[model samples]
Target chain A: MTLLERDPKSPLTWSGNLPVTSRYTFGLAGEKFFRAIKDEGKIIGSYCKKCDHTYVPASQFCEKCLAEVSDWVDVGTIGELHTFTVLYEGYDGARLVQPEIVAFISLGDGGLIHRLGEINLDEIYFGMPLEAVFLPEGQRQGSILDIRYFKPAG
Target chain B: MTMRKVAVIGAGMTKFVRRAQETPKELSWLATRMALESCELTLDDIEAVCMGTAPDSFDGIHMKGEYLSDGAGAWRKPYMRSYVGGGTGVFVPIQGWYHVASGMFDVVLVVAEEKMSNFYPHAQAAFLTIFDHTTERPLGPNLLWIFALEMNRYMTTYGISKEDIARVSVQHKRNAANHPCALLGDPDITVEDVLNSEVLAYPVQRYDVSPVSDGAVAIVLAAEHVAKRLTDKPVWVEGVGWNLDTAHWTNRDLVYPRYVEYAARMAYDMAGIKEPKKEIHIAEPYDPFDYKALHHLEGLQLAERGQAPQLYIDGTAARDGNMPVCPSGGLLGVGNPIAAAGLMKIAELFWQLRGEAGDRQVPGQPRRGIAQAWGDLMQVGTVVIMGR
Candidate 1:
């Protein structure tokens, strides 16, 4: 039956009019990017001389300064926690049995905001220091999940 | 030094909801019909059409302007679409101002709509895409994170508290209680209640943010000559201004909207409004989030920064207050349908100035009012000042 012919009161729904798109990634390039962090325990950033801005989660262009970033900077593993929240409600398809703390951590030059791992909620505070922990090389996916969140600074 | 006047002769809208069962085209058609009917004009009477939607991705329809032509009654008509995220709703009307001010079209129809529910699983994830796609999105930050960061800075720098900011939400939503189309109006709530609400980010709670709604709104503008002939009491669009800021949102301080201030100053200069706080009777300063109302209040120079929340506590920003803000319940209560929400603010100002707002009318006679919308990662400011 045609979409309009179906009963409007029925619970069944379709995405006929709505549009959808998927993402694509290169095999070797994606692998190398992920494997570096997993095996070497290093953090990567892209630097642009035209804009003079460094970005985490690395990028090809300096959006504001509008210059291409050809140089890579090694971000120090330790940083300070600017602010954080322990989310009680499930979000974006991930349901956690226990709530998770997503934090905004400030590096020396810039900062990276990400989820925290293996940390007690009560132990966290504003301005607290933390460090990144890379995933084991064998289990690396070459994606953002490389560091798997940061840990408390000693 | 010069004057350019435009008038809104037509209006249209769609039934607002949490999720639209109709397609994007159908939604546009619904609002377009209502706006045309209000103006006592048919689609044929419209000289041109200007469309506004928050983001191409929110509706999951890229190049949505072309797809929505049939519903907006733009078939074979000059059509254009522009967006400024949350600011698109108000920007649509500003675009209409140009259409008439430049003498390009005598009658221009402005339409704004959004169907946020289409981004299923999580609309907040849609916000993840709004950040630096590669730099910020990988962090899995939600939309509220940016607001939270800004709110935190506002609070820390100005010494504002959660309760102080919460008062604006309480007052605005309470004012919305009388609004005809208010979606989340509640009078019984107190500042304590807002403070107690779940902390999504450090300072932004659920109540602090505008609800995700599915709806559409439209308004028709006519040049002075045609507008004077169409209606005996046409609200004059005395001035309009829109400006965009750098996308480097992180570099700037979010305590106040600098771009909004620049845009408002430009409009006020054109409208000959030397004193907005005293001359303007009514206002709708984009309240997509409750704190935003206060932020924009300061940005528009309605009140001094860090003083807006105190104004709310003093009942000065209420419906019958000295200078009422968001009398139509705003996005918090009235429902935010993206682009449509800003147009709705313009319509509300139109109704108030014409003395046509039945139930949501302010206490005394109001001569002039201003409506402003901010969007595009808080980069764009669209301001319109209207007078009777």
Candidate 2:
């Protein structure tokens, strides 16, 4: 019998993760950005004079001007919350004991997306002043986690 | 409306290697800089950007095009990413062609990048997701196994021999010796070496397959008026076409690639060429696998059905011969970084047509060339024809 003429029967099914693992290098700008956070406990941004803009999280080029940005500056720890969301469930839909507040904090011309701490979810509001809290020295790794979380500025 | 003519003004590529120390974004930037520099144009001169990358699985990054936009010099400009498995490389220039032919953009940047090494252990694992979950994934079939089946079918159907196919690998690798960026260019390679190589699957030996690679290629495309100002030796884009068959690869005959023919026909129609074998001066058929080069040549109607092997045997496909195939060393000799490999062919044709390919340039100053790329369960074909 032809493939199209085959009789209908029980359908077949299969499920599995793609048999692949990945190891990504923190890119050129990322390596420098993370190193500064880990070694110096600093927040830095790449400044582009052509566009007169500074990009947080550091970047190799300015998106607006398409020019290489070599001038990196300390963006400082204090920032204003541009947006926030409270998550009560984990990625797999599991309930959390305490809801986590995530927010985008504006720094330089760009911003950072991280978790908010030291403030109740009800008290979290847009444009709220916040400061990054870095992990204790020696406990810091060259990662975004180097900044443990953002909290209300004193 | 009359389609505005488009021309390739400049081309650039990173070395095809087993692994790249640079990130995908950095690789994209390097190629972008080289291409823009080749044309003496900057990002400010580019009006739009077209990016082609295959399988986010290989790079281990989702939305890879968006992540690579800035490096491709897309910053604050109209940008888009196009994909069709391996066909993406060739399709990207086609995408750029329309952007100019449509008159929406006067100058466009086309970039294709692939970093297969990011997939740990073996990049073959990433290809697992490309299979149908219910019908094929359960079979656990890798690309080599399926391609072996196609290779076996082609041989049996045409009464072809292993030695005849091995010659393609030998020829391409030897040709690659002249390519500065080639990863596997072996000048003294022999057909016997291919025949004796380790067999990954029956009939598919180690030498038969293209290496997994990391690389990026970029080209600048401009409308006729802008191309005249950019460079005097602009290679005009004569035609472009692409076609995809059903994902049910099992349902189709494995002996020949019909989709490639359809796509080639579409391109020939647009280019106003009635005889591809006569009109196409240089043919860079995809050679990720040696037999694939021959397979695509037949599909592109450059050779008779099941008779492509004769081209290599008769010296007609040699770099100095009548139709120099894969003088850029092809994916077999250079490296197969998926999407970038496809765009590499476009770059090859651009250099060849402009008589600027250096040591790898073909003789007699060939005026027109055709590049074809095949991918996706062996179901899609992308073809581009360019000429001076």
Candidate 3:
């Protein structure tokens, strides 16, 4: 008996790409979160009283308590770096001109992932205090990029 | 090992809409919360969660089942998602039934959600990928175009006319006037209105097709003991059956959906239902298109082939009729949000069987009802028979 294997000589393969496009709404909480950043130049979070947790970037429900979080609070522009990673290449695997430092900045009970600026890679450390840098009000488009990056706080 | 009996204790759904401000996750959460509250239960009480959502392309989210897990109340618990194209809605509850019927979980939460509005221009664009890449895709076929062919075949084979099929839309739309969550409920919709509506594809008019929608639906299933504890009116899951035809739809005869009949037969056998037309008092067949309702009825053996439209003509499919079909408006009036629409039919059965379907309830107290969903290149059929 012969075992079946991939027949390299077979010409029975077809290749194609899915032709689909999409447009997304920011959602209930997302709209509020982005609007706060764009209009007020402030960071907001949805508070779940049951879990005593505040979700950064805002959300409608708390995963821990499975409770609806309607309480919105400004977590302020200040946060502390909880973790960090440096990307040396673009998403397409193209080598970048400069390394990009991305960090998870802890706010209240939750955090935001943003790029760290105005700091040297060798000096970056855990628990470093940071503050957000926003673009000019006229340029803000209710997007995450509205907050340019997180710089080291005094 | 003895199989444990499972029953639906509660069900809930969000309003069907063309566009929703809430994200897909939020929609699932809203439905899940309401389902739990209906039975005075909480996330802690649920032992397992089963999630169902059709093609991720609709929402532009990959691995959507995992993305929607926490929102479905699956945190720190056993959770799984099932997909059978559009059949996911009815299939998810069947998945939940097994969780309890297997004596593995006392209480299970089943959720089905779809956010089709995320697909730009129209959700139909996403369906373009569902076809065979070589054989069907190159022909540039959309869902409406292909279904038009099937509709033509069905009409030609049965010698049915478009006027008879238009009646199904009018009746279902009128019935939806009573459904608070329906998107296209119209009490005054007439046959002429449907016939006059803009034609999308030949033999398939705008009114003949269900609208693209976004929505979510959730149902709570519990074992006999827990269901009895939760509510006096428990709608038992009597039988569930699903079957798939060849993916190469071109090779098959479009005159009849033999797959639906096979699935219905499997369900009837397990349900101990000898005469589906007599034993099943109500039916919620997938009706994404007006003719589909009649097509599925014949497949479910509720009526003879080509004669299913007579049920609508004679008023037997009315809410107050002897054998009511799609009393909750079906997909025609309720809106077709893919997976969510299928689950909506199951939720309707749950409510109608419990006499909880307020203004839409059928008279004479319907004791048993069936809900079926069809999906994929018109290849799969999922059926569930529920009883009080």
If both were scored by lDDT, which would come out higher, candidate 1 or candidate 3?
Answer: 3
Clashing pairs in 3: none
Q: What's the best-to-worst order under lDDT?
A: 2, 3, 1
Error of 1 at A27 (Å): 15
TM-score of 1: 0.85
User: What is the lDDT, from 0 to 100, of the residue B81 in candidate 2?
Assistant: 100
- Output the lDDT of residue B236, model 3: 95
Put down candidate 1 lDDT per residue, B243-333, tens digits, no spaces.
Answer: 8886656545467788999999999998888888998888899988888888998989899978888778887788888988888888887
Give the Å error, residue B246, model 1.
4.1
lDDT of each: 0.77, 0.86, 0.85
Q: Report, for all candidates in order, the number of backbone clashes.
A: 6, 0, 0
Q: Lowest summed lDDT over 10 consecutive residues: which window, candidate 1 chain B? A: B132-141
Q: Which segments of candidate 2 are over 4 A away from where they belong? A: A1-154
- Best by the TM-score measure: 1
Cα lDDT, model 3, residue B343? 94
Clashing pairs in 1: A34-A142, B11-B35, B12-B34, B12-B35, B13-B31, B183-B333
Q: Write candidate 2's Cα lDDT for A1-154 as tens digits.
A: 1111222442232223345555556777878888898999988999999888787868888766678899999999999876544543332223457756666577887767567788986686557899999999799887777787899999
